[model samples]
Target: MTTRVRDERGSAAIEAAIGLPAFVLFVGMIIAGGRLAIAHQSVQAAAADAARAASISRDARTADATARREAEASLANQQIDCRSTRVSVSTAAFRVPVGQAADVTVTVSCRLDLSDLSVPGIPGSRVVRATMSSPIDTWRERAARGFRIPDAYADVWGQS
Candidate 1:
């Protein structure tokens, strides 16, 4: 007598054992991607705020300070706790002659840690960068300020 073969016995359990881990891993990845995306948006907004703050300033000296402060504040407000952060501001536009179009550019970079996921081949953290520019008002008149300018930028004002 030939023995009958079973087609369905233990199949569901076996399949689940193999598939559940994959499904859970997939969901973890989705959540990680979403967190990264939100971080990107937050950094981008921080850059924009930095640029805006810089652009409204009367000179490069003040612009750099304002941009840095704004960018830091924005990141904090967004609840982004970056492992490291760097901010760069270009204030050359402030040197342009009055009545000409110019802009301030701000770039922000932040490293976000994702090591908790332990995804294979993925680094412990990823760096995100965002750059934004804001137009400076051509009609705004800048006044010489009593505040001491940083030595690094003193040459810009013809100061020895």
Candidate 2:
């Protein structure tokens, strides 16, 4: 009985050793996932804000241009490096309503690659992207707003 219990004691230690690294890895993945989720949400908010700004104010691309700046602000609040943020916008020529605006699409993407920044032990970074569609102040249609895309424009579904 003593020999058997002693053998089981070593087995528990061995099991612990084997499980520790895996448990740590799982926890790390969870943390990484959460951080990436936050980044994605920030991008999405920035895109929405930019698109709304563009549509309501007829700012067009200028509105989309604010996405990065606003997103950076959000990341700053989160204490995350947002210097790698990229933002874009696509607007449909079709108006939202007779007296309203057209619709603009805004997209934000970011990759937190700390290799260039030289953070230690973090291994790899993450990439997050978000897109939003906003109404623009065009003179087309509110009730019968036809989806008039520009020659150089494509929706997210169209992008390969």
Candidate 3:
């Protein structure tokens, strides 16, 4: 009587075929996670920059525009390709009287594209948001409210 030997031919090929896809999927997931983390950090930085920029402005209108522009510039500098971006500036602090404590807040939202990763179960895009606030200088001169006497006419108008 002869013992039968099991034929192991093609077993390696089958194992490779099964393992390769799983390996690819794992790598894809890692790449996707890393991308998201970096994007979040970048967005946070953008929000900080925006808040600081807005806080330095003398008026609410200028703060709004400056915050948006600074956020966009920060994202661009970081090479983040956002499909859509929204920058919201809360300048309510601008209403605060001079010589008082106030702060400017900025929120930045960026929609990042993940379709290129082609990772299964991952959304085609994700929105990352960050909010930051910066204190305005307590002694900084802010825009005057209501009617103001012109510098040239201040003497005649008695400095309203």
The most accurate candidate by lDDT is: 3
What are the lDDT figures for the candidates, one per model? 0.88, 0.61, 0.90
Ranking by lDDT: 3, 1, 2
Instruction: Report the candidate with higher lDDT, 1 versus 2.
Output: 1
Provide C-alpha RMSD values for all models, in order. 7.3, 11.0, 4.0
Structure candidate 3, residue pairs in collision? none
Quote the positional error of residue 59 for candidate 3 in Å: 1.0
Model 1, residue 121: distance off in Å is 13
Q: On a 0 to 100 scale, what is the lDDT of residue 64 in model 1?
A: 96
lDDT of 3 by residue, 105-149 (tens): 999999988873346556678899999999999988788467365
What TM-score, over all chains together, does every model reach?
0.82, 0.63, 0.84
Candidate 1 TM-score versus the reference: 0.82
- Candidate 1, residues 96-154, lDDT tens digits: the string is 76799988899999988776333555667889999999999988865444555569988
